[model samples]
Target: MSNPLSEAEDSPLFITSLAKGLALLAAFGAGRPSMNLVEMAEVTGLNKSTVQRSAYTLEALGYIAKEPQSKRYRLTPKSLEIGSGYLQTSELIERANPYLHELNRSTRESCNLLEPSGTDMTYVSRFASHKQISIHVPLGQRLPMYCTSAGRAYLSALSPEEAAAIIARSRLVAYTQNTETDPSRLAKIVRKAHGDGFACSNEEYYVGDIAVGAAIVNAEGRPLGAVNIAVPFSRWTLKDALADLAPQLVNTARSISNAARGLKPLVSPATG
Candidate 1:
């Protein structure tokens, strides 16, 4: 599909109702919910006319609803239907969850099933290892593309140009003293992870914690996401984090890749 911003201002394929509707659904995020027409227009870059129609259609479809007092649109619990339907049929999640559990049980550390979200990463599924002292990251927590092992693993799976774009946009915060904020250095690190088939981060996203991850890609080599095992600095140093968990994480991710052999890329044009 041509870049809608550059191509026909209103190509029907580009103006696809499904695409526009899903874009409206995606417009809601962690900080921004209950969007007024302007916020929705800004996020979707669609005209108020288009956004208004999309919102009304979504509300009628039970995917979104208008707030009583605010008069802004918010996704309903029914909005989960789209994601839940995908999860229900995706062999990747069903096959990968057990391995996350096995790794967590063996390592006694939290493990996750990651999925790419543009340049960022998110957990589609996870099993906690620190049940007694577990860091409970919910199902859809987003992590930085630059500072997270899961993010880097997904980055490592991208084409050089794609990965470079992600790195360039990242502010590369020094989440901890050990974080790598330089773009060139981070590129080299991602390149190394690409070559090594794994990635690791020590207190880069979460301070005092370390994670090692590996990417799972489809036959086209497009990244499906990744899996990681995380342990705290108090429980293990960076060296120990890699030494102890790297092999298990790699094994689990490979298993997911093996199972996701025919996975298709989700090129949601409007959202992408």
Candidate 2:
């Protein structure tokens, strides 16, 4: 596969410094909230000098702040303005918000809206159930396409070849004993999802969690993203989820897709 970084390096319009600064900002997350210059360089694959320059720029701009005691950099609340800007302006998210909340209310389970980001599905929006649940999937959490129901649902809307290419690029590591890493098997599951209009994961990505997902597509039948309802195993069985929640999940997805028909397509064409 061709390297996107190398391709960007060749582009005349690509801004290397801007990319470095953004990459540095992205390096801070739930796991690594703060980092020294060396840690930032390692996480972002940039040299120490570039990391230093990017950190300084970001600090000056109020996106990140350095701790005087430890000399580690952390993202400020101002950094959220970047993602907040997208949420404030996104039509798709706006349209899906009410529907996802309704699904959460009806199912009494956690619901999420996820979009394809590289080879993973990123949670763009979430609605938690009123009932107590052990798992908490925060917005922006990413899960591999091969083992996630939402990922399979999104992939099912693409051409078989396109979906296969993405699977080929994914690192098929088993997150649990039930995680299926076989490319061929995953392709078959995606095909089934396309036929059924919904996909399911049986504790594949996370233990004790089961989910059902359906793709939200444009008028052209291309996926813009997916809607998922996740439940803990203690509350619902696979058979119960399929019988009760699957229909509602598919219906909600269809309603969103219908609303999205008049909008511009959000999904990019297959690069390969």
Candidate 3:
């Protein structure tokens, strides 16, 4: 498969410094929240001097900050503004918010709006259940597409070949005892989701987390994302949760999709 970003790198308009800065920012994640210049260079594969320059720029921009005692760099709350900017601008989130809240209210479970990112599904929006037993899935958290209900739902909306290609590219490691690591088995599950209009994860990604999801499609039937409701195993059985909540989840997904299609085009008209 051809990489669009790599292809763009050959364009004269491609800004190398901007790309390097973004890469430097991406280098600081959950596992590596705080990094020294050497660590940042190692992680981003940039030289020390380049990393230093980019780090200084990011620090100046308030996206990153250096610790006084450790001399390590960490992302600041200001960096969240970048993601917040996206959420604020997204029509999908706007359209899906009410439905997500409705699903959460009806199911009394944590509801999520997830979008596929390469081989993972990222939580873009969430409505936390007030119930005591609910699982907490924060926005921007990425889960393996191979073992998640949202990922499977998104896959189910794709063509068989496309879904297969995505699964082949995924690192199908067993996240839990229930996680189906075999490509063939995972494919079968995705096929079932395609037919059933919903996908289920029975403690696949996390041992105690059970979720059911349905794909949100555009007017062209292309998947925009997925809507998921998560419950803890201690409170509800997978069978009971699917039996009770599946219909509501599918309906909520459809409502969001329809609302999304009704919104005005995001692109601006070309001016002469």
All candidates: CA RMSD (Å):
3.8, 1.5, 4.0
Report RMSD for candidate 3: 4.0
Report the lDDT tens digits of candidate 2 across residue range 57-137. Answer: 999999999889998889999999998887788888999999998998888889899988888888999999779978878
TM-score, every prediction = 0.78, 0.96, 0.93
Better of 1 and 3 by lDDT: 3
Best by TM-score: 2
Which candidate number has the best lDDT? 2
Give candidate 2 misplaced runs (Cα > 4 Å): 1-5, 269-272
Candidate lDDT values, in order: 0.80, 0.89, 0.87
Clashing pairs in 3: none
**Which residue runs does candidate 1 get wrong by more than 4 Å?**
1-11, 16-18, 47-49, 132-136, 157-162, 165-179, 217-223, 261-272
Q: What is the per-residue lDDT of model 1 for residues 1-272, given as tens digits with 9 covering 90 to 100?
A: 24535565466556566778888888897778689988999999899999989888888889988899989888889988877787677677887887778877888778888777655787888777654543557777788878889889888988877788777766677877888889988899999999988899987777677789899887778888889887777778878777777887888888778778798756421223
Error of 2 at 211 (Å): 0.3
- Tell me the spans in candidate 3 whose CA falls farther than 4 Å from its real position: 133-135, 262-272
lDDT of 1: 0.80
- Sort every candidate by lDDT, greatest first: 2, 3, 1
Q: What is the lDDT of residue 240 in candidate 3?
A: 91
Report lDDT (Cα) of residue 131, candidate 3. Answer: 85
